[model samples]
Target: MSADALTFDCIVVGSGHAGSCAALAARDSGCERVLIVEKSPPEWVGGNGYFTAGAHRTVHGGLQDLLPIVKNVTPEIAANIDLAPYTADEFTRDVMRLGDGRSHPDVVKALVDGSRDAVQWLAERVHVPFIFSFNRQAYLVNGRQVFWGGLALSVEGGGKGMIAADRAALAAAGVETWFSTAAIELVIDGDRVVGLQVSREGESITLRSRAVILACGGFEASKDLRAQYLGPDWQRAKVRGTPYNTGDGLALAQRIGARLTGDFAGCHSTCWDANAPDDRGDRVLSNQFTKSGYPLGLMLNAKGERFVDEGEDFRNYTYAKFGREIMSQPGGFAFQVWDSTTIPWLRKEEYADDVVERIWGDTIEELAAKLVEKGLEDKDAFVQTIRKYNEAVRAFQAERPEAEWDPAVKDGVSTQSSHLQLSLPKSNWALPVEQSPFLAVKVTCGITFTFGGLAIDPDTAGVLSDATGKPIPGLFCTGELVGGLFYRNYPGGSGLTGGTVFGRKAGREAAKLSGAAR
Candidate 1:
């Protein structure tokens, strides 16, 4: 391939979940020459999708409830996939609750409507076994097959099996896979996306296509971009994933007049050890809050003062606390403190290996020492803080009877309180940190995705021009690129679900346009 020229019916840039699905959808829809250009080699699965917890949301009830077509979805798929029974009104209300009045109603509705079909379609291609966990109200599909193998397989099938099946299916459909190829630019003709300029092993190639899909991902890895978008406060965030997602596609699209949506970015909150070095020496950890339950203890800055409500949605609170609050603090970091009772629960309950290690200290004193050793806190200040906290806890408990004692713990209970102590001790209240051998772990908030991206029409998933309020010709977007669609609040797991739902729409539409052109 040379930088001079190549041609295809459609070009999909980035091989993450969205790009892969778009590529497959184009080929499956009868485009003869579809190409998937991936920057990473085949061996390296894209980090974001691969490491995700794989939660998805779909609406249920309303007029669709009476449609036979909707009802006809297999029991297995329905059972595995939760239908939240959201009426259009209810759905809109829920989105609005999170979106804070900024969401595009049409796009929100489209996603709610399309999720069922998307799940069914993806399930049909992959052997997704539905598990009835978390009660009958919720459903769980085996995403590991999709994540590991790229296809659905029997219980015995591993990641290799799924990947082979997915690759084979694409190959059989004649979707060209160009691993180790990087898309450097979007070839634009006026306001329309015409092709892509790509590079591989020092070679540059221009692949012309009727449509280009910019699914390259957000700027989670770019420190400069993070500082610019998330404000100067983000200078302390730890980059948790791959270094490759530097917003190349986003930059190219913006340069070509693509409109941005939402604010600079969004983030997830959870416990991560600041001490552990990632493969790149970037100090960070994973976002696996569900497994850990919640950090039931108090979190404080270097000054050893309680900040945000520790019991807030462990996930969302992490974002609000670390991303917005703590990151802006004097030191740009914070520490989590808990008693001996909390350590065992944290170790057993939290899934992140880093968090478990951070649950050190037999007493509040030991915990303070550990934090000081980690260079997260000053020894004298931390010790004084704990002494004050212990005094507060004792005073609070004295004010209440033992029979009336309640740890006032929310989110999760410390192991000592739950396992060692039979009941909540008013003595353990989160007032002052006067406990002995306390445990503290340093943590920094890092970004996950840019909430702001190319603005698109909610109804059609087509990129919108800010000036004209019209769709960009021959262009469509999904995932993080569709902005204002989720302006203020996010429906749980809507990000990935939106990607699947709208990526399918974009692919099908692009394929239709390509076929019509032919």
Candidate 2:
């Protein structure tokens, strides 16, 4: 290996959002020599980051507070938008609530505390094109765009745009990145990680460094890992991100006795198009394959039964766990049925004719008949299910005439009443699927990232050692590789914000350690 290759103060293993944030933060924190090694080729530079929707959840005082950072909102538009302030306490509660209170308090607190600052840093330093998520998170209510969910901001062109800005920022910071460099092992001297042994173009080279941060992501793409950790059904699940995240960081850390933490059996999965590729994400279409329109409609399994309450909560709160539900259904797939009333409201980016295959039927029975060809086992059961659901909706509407259908808030338009009720109720926004020209889209589970990863110190983002129950010297971790913040389910957009927050911390800490070593 060249002498220059062995001289980096900090070597980051990955080039995703977290790695980029780490490299940039290292340079800013006074690390003179920083390097990022990517396992994928130059074309696949941003790892799983390139496949994200770029939704960033952060603490802010409603629309006014975010106005300064976002580029999409205008004076006229801002006046017609309704967005409530998202407090740190609220964000903290959401993370814990969705995680079934299993999330590590320290990790959750660190993420919540650093969220706003991390977002601002990204906007200012990395020049990420921030915009109000009008198309995805808001709904038209009484001539105003009401942002229902806690999330409200996203990048201009989503993941692709964010990655472009991150790459540019890395270049401006003079951080060198070596593509197609796979981290084979972590080189340790005593208790400190001194360097990395990597394979570049079939040649193994040892590159020395003062500190190393593993942000290479989780084992979502490995079918074997999925079967071993996330259950056998997950082996058939489609990967929603980069195929390169096969637990290399976890494997390297395990070799050195890094403590394993978080939910090994849980992951951030989503309802994706049934036709989407199984092994990897589509770079061109990216996250558009996501099928989150179920909140506005009905999701029926092959048994022609509503397994989950379609409107238990906003899409942001419930989309992540619904994928696991879909995986458990017969044939490991479900159909999202929406009438003309809600069809137009479905995000065009996701439900557009060119994006996903859509099946149309003039009547409920016809839709059921068409769905039988896909995977519906009982056509008669399917037809009866919709009829019963429609009756429940009618009965509820008759009892509570004042209960209006509002998607912006959890409008109590439910299918359950004291007089007449179904076994499983559509809790909110339960408009009957009776409108003509109904639409149904086939969907399957798409695993995003695994929740099982290395344990770390929330303050310094240092990987914790299993032997001593302390921070591993000269080693740090961030991104999806550092877990203990999520379990069972994940709140939408928190992943990106958490990555940035901990990535920034890891970078600064690693840089400090590097200086001390020098």
Candidate 3:
């Protein structure tokens, strides 16, 4: 094809949620010809966004305020739901707290302020099937579905549904997309980006464009990059998303003097099923491989010791960092143990018999013995750990008989009290593992996305030049490639919302750049 045929007003790299949103926004903003180029083949399309749970964190006035946008919540169902308002301040605090206060204030403010409008645009414009996250974010308590962790919405079919909706929107908006097109470098015109050089059909081709947006994602899937940036332990971490995100956007932008920022040594990792594929995510099972029930039970390392306070906070807030803790353990794996009391409450999507390998025992001793074959180095240590944990639970229960175990809220049902306290306390929902038919599931670290990425202007999502410390004209970024929003850890559900918010801004700015250049 001729170079003129490949020319576009704006070109977005990556066909994931962020890129799709950018392309659609460019078209809506009056860009005559917008294009998206994805490195992965047609089969591996959506990048890391396809493996997400599709949860989106946004500010709202509670259940009533969200019901109008969600398709799953009928009037009758909404009546039985109790969803507290998630304010902008609360959302901002969650990101800052999880990021250890290293998150850029301006970037975080833009994310928090734009989240609601971005979600609404996704629902109304992109036709993403938004639904109340009943299974993943809510718990049944006294016949009422109480939502916690400031997260209440998800796509209908999780990540798969989200990608489908985005594809449809892109096609409807007349945005052209090309798969198996790997961007090699940003075509630099003096200090500004003018186009992209890409590899297609094993041939290097230069595609001209007035502006470019990088949304191809982070370096979590590259073992070399992970080992180099996040440490050697990260080399063994299983990829929870596409294997295609090997820092292409970061490399491409850095070649043009783009500044790199954010947490290079940190990432969003999670407890994943040990038996799941290590290189790529399973499209059919997708996010179901996550083993997030550790908060509802106990996580013991191979040494049969509790490393973290399992109930330090809600599962949404703590799951990301716990994977790093598990990776630092012997064999880079851990087991989650739950008795009949909470096993029934485990998310069926994650713990179903067909989803993960399960080991069952009538007693704690037998359970520990069974785990010996599955990498538990010391059987006796495992049994003793549970015994001590149960004793602490019982002691706390005796001291606070008035405190009931409510998974829906922080009820102060803890393992530490005036009577006795364990060294590592389950600070909330402390339940004893004394029930018969105990279950155990092995888990390993699943790397979601890397925290290190390109630095961008908070308002326009324009990539900043490392040399000038200013916006690089005609260069923009979004998705996991745009950084400084997170530091050491991440608040659950913020990724998708942040990606869309910045993607919209990037697209509008890029469209204006394209018009001015013409």
Candidate 4:
């Protein structure tokens, strides 16, 4: 790298939610010249953020507090809804428990503490219009929509709109972004990062900058990396996001000896449509590839046996891990079986015809025969499993006539097997697949992002040196590259918000060092 290379105050890699936030925050923090380098063309510059449905898990002070941010909530709507506070303590506890205490406490604390303000902070800079998540976060009760879980609002029009908002803000802020430019290496000299080496349209270029924020993504899209870090057969897993997220930032950071953290093999996997393409689906038809109605049904492996306790917890907490369990099954797939009783109330994502593969039958034998025709399993085994499950549900129904079946919260509805021979038992909200028009939707394991990356100072979002565990000058990281915020598992909708929290922090802190020119 030459000493006379062109320099800027700050350079942000990638154009996803994190990168967009970082670039904006740097400019806001008084960085005179800010640049964002994205490997993808401008059309696909948003990375995985564009593929998401804009669900954000933030600690809120109930519906009353949410009225200001959520622009579409009418007075009538607010009056009919019931919501409670989601304090920082509750958010922190969930983060700790969500990862089984494997998550770094400092990072989790930052995420929880910065969450509520972070959403507002990003929205003000990007003009993101927030709206209530009526489909997945709410259930109809007494002619009113009641929101559950810790999630409340999402960016209007989902992730695509979010990207558009950020793009406009970037233009308004006079920030420059270079498309089709891939950062290959960090320009390190005497333990100080000075610039970046990038290849733009196959032409090499050296650009010097006081700070670099690496926020591209993780290794979920790389077959070789997935096999190496996540073990064998992981390459067969479907990608739920952008194919361009092939760990460019993680590789660049590792080249500089950034200390890695979090569970390397862990990821945010989910039950996705088995017939979906290997890469992500169309941005216009996003959220169609994810099928999340498993809580209302039974998931059987290839051998026609239930493999997990679907009702062990709410879908928000359990779906992230169940997808990984499905990959561990006999054929790397699972079938979500339901009946007419539970089908009508199923999540709207299940009805996306282009992305989902569904089967139906009026009788258990007919359903099993249909599955056998697909080369799945023997008809006898499927019938026996269904019969045993039906018996248990009926027994429970007879014993507990007062049980209230609620979907928003964990209702006490469950099954009771008198035989006690069932290998996998449903813990809560269990209903038998005995009604006419039995339905089954096939789904495979789909990974979102890996939970491993370099460790960073949670306060400043600076990448820590592996040799001394000290902050590396001019090296900051956000998005998926800053690990220890997530570990074995994660809560749904936290990924994007986590990126916002650290991205803004990284941009501000990185900009603070921009005054120290070489």
Better by TM-score, candidate 3 or 1: 3
Query: What's the TM-score of every candidate structure?
Result: 0.74, 0.99, 0.99, 0.96
RMSD of model 4 against the true structure = 2.2
Candidate 4 residue-wise lDDT, 117-151, digit = tens: 88888667678878888887888878888777777
Q: lDDT per model, in order?
A: 0.56, 0.92, 0.92, 0.84
Model 4 regions more than 4 Å off: 1-5, 417-421, 516-518
Per-residue accuracy of model 2 over 1-518 as CA lDDT, tens digit each: 57885778899999999999998898899898899999999988888888988999999988888999999978999999999999999999999999999999999999999999999999999999999999999998889999978999999989999999999999999999999999999999999899999999899989888789999999999999999998898999999989999999999999999999999999999899999999999999999999999989999999888899989999999998999999999999999999999898899999999999999999989999999999999888888988999999999999999999999999989999988898998999999888899999999999999999999999999999999989999899899997899999988999999889999999899779877322
Candidate 3: the clashing residue pairs are none
Model 2 lDDT, residue 195, Cα: 93
Cα lDDT tens digits for candidate 3, 266-321? 89999999999998899999999999998889999999999998889999999888
lDDT (10s digit) by residue, model 1, range 1-518: 44334788788776655666677777777677888887877765443554443444555452234123332235544443323344446556656765567776777788878876765665566433322223211212343111110111121122233334446556677778788888888787887778888898889877888887767777766778877877666655665544566787678777767777775655443344455343222312233322222244566677655565554432321332244555665576677776655444443323345444555666555666666655555656766655554554544445533433122223122212322231223222243343444555566554456667777776666777767778877777766666666653464456666777777777777787687322
Over 4 Å off, model 3: 516-518
Worst 10 residues of 2 by lDDT: 509-518
Query: Against the correct fold, how does model 2 do in TM-score?
Result: 0.99
Number of clashing pairs per prediction, in order: 26, 0, 0, 0
Could you tell me which residue pairs clash in candidate 2? none
The local lDDT score (0 to 100) that residue 72 gets in candidate 1 is: 28
> So what's the TM-score on candidate 1?
0.74
